[model samples]
Target: MREVAAAAGVSRQTVSRVLNDHPSIRPDTRERVLAAMAELNFRPNRAARMLTTARSRTIGVLAASASSLFGPASSLDAVENAAREAGYFVTVAHVSGPEVAAVEAALDHLMAQAVEGIVVIAPQQRVQDAMAAVSLQVPSVTLHGAGLAGDDGVFVDQVEGARLATRHLLATGHRRIAHLCGPGDWSETRARRDGFLEEIAAGGEDVTGIVSREGDWTAESGAAIGAELLADPELTAIFSSNDQMALGVLHAAREAGRRVPEDLAVVGFDDIPEAAYFAPPLTTVKQDFAELGRRCVARLVERIEGVGAVGGGGGAGSATGSATDSAAAPVPPQLVVRASA
Candidate 1:
């Protein structure tokens, strides 16, 4: 502070005001102080600021070990970037399992860091239930798996994404459509399964019945399920819960000497980067994981700053300056059509 003040010909108090973004500082003075700080490579001490303001300027992220998944990993990156832009640091704690004990341990770790708020990437029903049971005191937001929006949460409308994928198959004249879903414990699995079933029922197809199987959201599980589905010669299309599993279905179809689109059309969720490069290319739903992450940070910061309600009163909106406004409809995932479906 002293070096920047001396270099900019201003008092230390003036430099502090500039650093804190005080509106009282003159425009020219603020510019001069910023320039001096940049030239001197001066950085504010977070510890001193915390002592003065009683704020750690840090946020906590609670997530499962599914960081290897495309959606969760991408969302984490987005949260980190948004937190940095907001002059806050992020601390992430990954729970090794879906049990309540693991969730409590992760929360305890974040609380020890004195985080101002928390964001939970909870895709499983068990994790959500655990979070609800813990009764977190700090302002918190959840990234829900189901499409239902929470007062303090944001989501990508997974049910609608599934509906889009299923409707596409129906439009293509696929009557015997089957669905390959994730584990029943995951909220995403139930929501996607419901959407697929609803759309199939809407078609009024008098086929034998709905053929569904659960997988672990992996290519291997998808391949095994796909192989089983291939035995039903009447099945015309399959909708896997995610892109990774869809890749397995593709491999199984090829191994069974089945032609894609012609013999068995397939659609998957989460248009991962590799989806387009698959053998026949993949038709999948694209979620804005980045936007979801940004919104989580923005909402949590608002709660921490007392500008938004704590817990589940309000703030189920997108971040300010985001592509969508809070008053507008929730962002919907897009279906990227390719040769596979």
Candidate 2:
């Protein structure tokens, strides 16, 4: 510290402020100090600082889905980047399933590492319940879970996304719309299913016998279900919970000798990058997973820094309230239309 301070021609206090990202430091002075540190190869002792400040400057991430999933993987990357910018390290624990025991084990691992807070990416209701059951001393936030009252979390509005897809089909004059949903245990599935139903009702369509099927959020499962759904000739359009399922519906449509948008229009959610490049160019809803990650870290850090209340309360942290507050509206999803629908 002394060598860098001398090199930068600044006092030790100014150097410290610059290192801590204090807003009071002048930009020129901050740049000079950073240049001096770079030249001197000065590396701050994180362990010694933790002892002095009683803060590990580390955040934990517990994800129920594998990193390969497009939404979860993108979210995880965003969290890591945001944490790094905020001068904090991240530790990840990927649970194999949403089972209570699995979640508990993942939490235990993160606790052992002494992380300052935790961010759970929960897609399933079971995972959300498990998180509620645990008594956490550290500040925690859930990503993608239903923002029930009294829960600290941030989520993409799955219902709104579903509504967008369904409305698009309706606007295209397709009344006999079918729905392909994910597992019933998932909060997203329920929200999307309800959204589809709500839209159908609002449109005054006679959906007395509309078809609905459940899939495992895999292209293969989608394909299998799609094949079965194609058996019904009355189904003029399909709203899939995700883009992968829409791809399956396309495959089934092809095998059944039905042309897209001519015989059966298909809409999907979560417009993954490849959605635009599909054979028929799928129309899907786009959720900002990266923004969700950034918000999750921001909320968690606010609670850790004592600027925000934990769970169910409002705080002056960022534009978005504390993670646990039900009042905070989730980031909305948008629809990207293409040839398929």
Candidate 3:
């Protein structure tokens, strides 16, 4: 600022006013400041600006990816776009494990950077529980979180989504079914599995012959579990908690000499980009994960700007199992019909 003011033959205050676009600055004076800034290759100091304006204009993301899953990865990308569009920069710290120490360390890393707000996104219940024990000092949003204190959440209705898939299969007269669930620690794994069982009970289907298998949310795990489940010829359908595992089921069925929707049916969650191009396109539940991330950032900004009530701040207790109860609207899931089912 000093160099620019000196080159422009104006006071530092005049240069500051020009930088902030104050309307009172004369046109010629503004032009001179711009020319001086260009000549000196001057860049505004973000730290100094924050000191003067009390705004960092930057948010932090603490994202977890237990296995490089599609949901967390997609959310990070969407958050970057949304924050940039809202005129803020973003910093990210990834939580590679479900341990409380990992989460706390990541939080500390972000907080030390002077971020004005934070976004916490982890799919595993254990991780969310871990986050609940730590106190956050800034406004925050959680995605698929346990609704830790001082944080609002944004999520898709995972249980209803699973029910949608299961309901569709039962409505089509397929009674003997299997459920390929994700890792036991993940919140999604529990919600989706419950939905499958609930819908099956609602349809009055006998549970004796149904197959339930747990996978590590990878295609290889899916194929392994699916192969054994497919050994039973009575199992006419399978509903996977995620699309990757669904792909593995398709592979297993193919190797087992079964034609999808002809000999057996399949349904999956999270309609990833490649679902439509599978050997036989997958029928799966679609969550607008990108939109979910965008809305989360928007809501966090509201809290950061002090526009509304914040969750559990100032030592208020925490809450969990947030569905439609969060400050932000829940993103509904849609079932897309394709040849697989």
Candidate 4:
């Protein structure tokens, strides 16, 4: 405070007021002190600051897994950025091993750190079950729509994204479309499959039952399922639950000598970075993981600030943004039509 005052040529009291964000300080004088502090890269000791104001300005993130897939990882980043901008420090714990035990350990670690709040970023049913077991010791929010079905959650509109992809297939005259769904434990997998099934039924076509195979959201798993789909002769179009799997499907199609869009088209969800450069330029639904991160932070901040969550009181809207807010929020997955589809 003294050094800032000396550098800015202001009184020590003025610098103190500026540092504390006192309303009594003149705007110009505060600006000078702040600029001087910035030039010196002066960061106030958080512990000292907290002594005066009982705020730790810290948040904890508990992730079921460290996999940076489109939803969980992206939302974690968004939450981190949001918390940082709001003047909060972040600590993250990546849970591993058995789902329930890992989550409990992660939460316990965060509790020891005394984080003001916590945000969970995993999408597994087991993760949700673990959260329920914890009873939310601190103000906590789940970024994915797991555990808190009736309560608001931050999630992408998976159902809408699936509808977009499946409707595109139907529009292209694909009647025998098959869905390569993700693991049954994920809420997104269920939502996406339901949306695809609903769209198929609404089209008034006799629904060819979804020839499904479970995957843990990996390209290898997709490839394994793709190989199986290739052996079946009647399948015309395939929508893998995610882009990684879609790429696997494309690989399998190439090996089987089937041409994309001519013999069998492919559509994938979560348009990952490399989807655009794939052999046939994968047609995929692009979801914003970064937005998920931001929402996580915002909601967590609300919990810390005692303002409650952003939407629906104590919770927020979908972490994946919404279908209608495509331009402004732009978190919903868009069908990036390409030669593959």
- The model with the greatest lDDT is 1
How do all models score by TM-score? 0.89, 0.89, 0.81, 0.86
lDDT of 2 by residue, 1-341 (tens): 99999999999999889878899999999999999999999998988778866678999999887677777888888889989877899999988776788888998999898788888887777787887677776777777754544545688888788888988888888878889988898778888888888888888745532646689888888889988888988888989988888898899899899899899999888899999999899999999877787777877877777632323333223324434454457888999999998
Candidate 4, superposed: residue stretches over 4 Å from native: 11-27, 68-70, 98-101, 146-148, 206-209, 307-331
Query: Backbone clashes per model, in order?
Result: 0, 4, 1, 11
lDDT: worst 10-residue window of model 1: 310-319
**Cα miss at 48, model 2 (Å)?**
2.9
Q: State the TM-score for model 2.
A: 0.89
lDDT of 4 by residue, 99-212 (tens): 577777887888787677777776777777776666555667667752224624567788889899999998888888888999898888888888898898887755564758
Please identify model 3 stretches exceeding 4 Å from their true place: 1-45, 145-152, 205-211, 307-327
For residues 1-341, write the lDDT of model 3, one tens digit per residue.
88899899999999999977789999999999999999999988988998997667889998887437888888888888999887788999988677889898998999888887888877777787888888888777777732233334677888889889998998888888889888887777887888788888888736422646679888999899999999998899999989999999999999999999899999999999999998899999998877887787777776665522443343212223233234454678899999998
Judge candidate 1 against the unseen true structure and give its global Cα lDDT, from 0 to 1: 0.82
Candidate 3, pairs of clashing residues: 150-311
Task: Superpose all Cα atoms of candidate 3 onto the true structure and report the RMSD in Å to 1 decimal.
Answer: 5.3
